[model samples]
Target: MRILVVEDQDSIRRMIEALVQARGYEVTAVSSGAKALDVILTAPHDLVLLDLMLPGQYDGFEVCRRLRADPSTRAIPVFIISAMDDPESRRKATEAGANAFYTKPFSPIALLKEIERLTTGKG
Candidate 1:
């Protein structure tokens, strides 16, 4: 499956890309929410791993909102992968239409399993 990873941290972004790629999935990584939007709008992605903190005008919440608002990309499954591990952040993520929520320093195995579940409909 094709996936888009929207993360600001260079190391985290690279790690996520590597992990997903190793799982035999195609991945597109971007450092900002705006760039992510552009990529998603132009290309089809099966899933999105979005970070709550982003540089530029829009935060991850806004990014998720925009994705959900667009018909072409609204149905895509999105998992919030961020360091914002507060209740409010989780609420906002859900309100923004995220399929799942994960905090930073996340378990790689759980993440891989979640992605597999979301992509293949098998948990």
Candidate 2:
């Protein structure tokens, strides 16, 4: 399966990439929301691991909204991995069409389990 990881932090991005790659899935990572959008629009992916506070014009919320709005990409699963842990952020993420949300300092095991569940229909 293919997974797109969108994170602005260089270290965090690399860590996520490594984690997902170790799971035997293809990973395409980007440092900005704009780049994420461009990549997603150009190609297909099984899942998207998005960070809410992103650089450039499109934040993670907008990215999710756009993906949901587009017929071609509407079915793609979006899992938010962000530092925003407040109820408002969670609500906004849900409203924006995220399938799941994991706050920062999240359990890697749990995240991996969710990814497995989303991509292969197995938890």
Candidate 3:
């Protein structure tokens, strides 16, 4: 499956990319939500792992909203990855149309499991 990871932190982004690549999935990693949008618009991705704190006009929430608003991408699965560990943050992510919410310091295996479930129609 093809996945897109939008994370600003270089180390974290590379870590996620390595983990996902190890899972035998093709991944496209970008540092900002805007770049993510550009790629999403140009090609198809099975799923998206988005960071809430982004370095652009659109945060992950806004990016998720925009994706959901677009007809072509509205059905794509999105998982919000953030360090904002609060009930409100989770609620906002769901409201913004994220399929799942994962906080920072997350388990790479668990995250991959969730991604598999979402993409495979098991979650």
Candidate 4:
């Protein structure tokens, strides 16, 4: 499975990349939402692990919305992982058509398991 991880934090991005790589999945990690959109537009990813807050004008929410709006990419699975652990954040995720929402300080194994379920149809 190919997973695209969008995280602004270097450490966190590298950590998630390593974790996903260990799971035997192809990973393409990007530091900003703009870069994510660029890659996402160019090719299809099996799953997208997106962070809510980003450094660009288009944050994860916007990215998610665009993905959902585009007929070609509307059905792609999006998982929102963010430090903004608020009701509003979760609401925004749902509005943007995210398949799952995860807060920061999340369990690595749990994330992996959920990714497995989404991509492979089994956890």
Candidate 5:
């Protein structure tokens, strides 16, 4: 499966990339929401791991909204991995069309499990 990971932090991005790659999935990692939108719009991915606080005008919320708004990409699963842990952030993510939300300091194993479940329909 193909997965797109959008994160602004270099270390975090690389870590997630390595973790996902170890799972045998193709990964495309980017540092900005704009780049993420560009990559995702041009190619197909099985899942997207997005960070809410992005470095561009289009944040993760906007990206998810756009993806949901576009007919061609509406069904793509979006899992938000962000530092925002408040209810408001979670609610906004849900309203913006995220399939799941994981806060910072999340369990890597659990994240991988969710990724597998979302992509392959198995836990």
Candidate 6:
């Protein structure tokens, strides 16, 4: 399945891309939420792994909101993968319509399993 990873940090983004790719998934990663939006709206993706804080006009939350707002992309699964591991952040992510939440330094296994479950209805 196709996975779009949106993370501003270069090292983090690379790590995530590598891990996800290693699991035999097609991954498209971007350094900003703007690029992410552009990519998503233009093409189809099975899942999105987004970081909360971004460096452009749009943050991950806004991206998720936009994706959820548009009927065409509304059903695409979005998972917030951020460093903000607080209750409020989690709540905001939920309110923004994320399918799942994972904090930074997340378990690769859990991510893979979630992707499996979300994309194929099996894990």
What lDDT tens digits, residue by residue, belong to model 1 across residues 1-123? 899999999999999999999999999999999999999989899999999899999899999999999999999999999888999999999999999999989999999999999988995
Misplaced by over 4 Å in model 2 are none
Alpha carbon lDDT at 102, candidate 3: 89
Clashing pairs in 5: none
TM-score quality measure for candidate 1: 0.98
Residues 1-123 of candidate 5: C-alpha lDDT, one tens digit per residue? 999999999999999999999989999999988898889889999899999999968999999999899898899999999999999999999999999999999899999999988887885
Q: lDDT score, residue 4, model 6?
A: 96
Superior by TM-score: candidate 1 or candidate 5: 1
lDDT of 6 by residue, 1-123 (tens): 889999999999999899989999899999988899899988899999899999979998999999999998899999888889999999989999998998878888988888788888785
lDDT of 2 by residue, 47-95 (tens): 9999999988999999999999999889999999999999999999999
Question: Which digits, one per residue and each the tens of the lDDT, describe model 3 over residues 17-89?
Answer: 9999999999999999899999999989999999999997989999999999999999999999999989988
- The lDDT of model 2 is 0.94
Q: What are the runs in model 5 whose C-alpha is more than 4 Å off? A: none
What TM-scores do the predictions have? 0.98, 0.97, 0.97, 0.96, 0.97, 0.95
- At residue 46, give the lDDT of candidate 1: 100
Q: What C-alpha lDDT do the candidate models reach, one value each?
A: 0.94, 0.94, 0.95, 0.92, 0.94, 0.91
- Backbone clash numbers for all candidates listed: 0, 0, 0, 0, 0, 0
Residue 18 deviation, candidate 5, in Å? 0.2
Give a tens-digit lDDT track for model 4, residues 6-120.
9999999999999999989999999898999899889889999999899978899999999899898887899999999999889989998999988989999999988988887
Give me the runs in candidate 6 sitting further than 4 Å from their true place: none
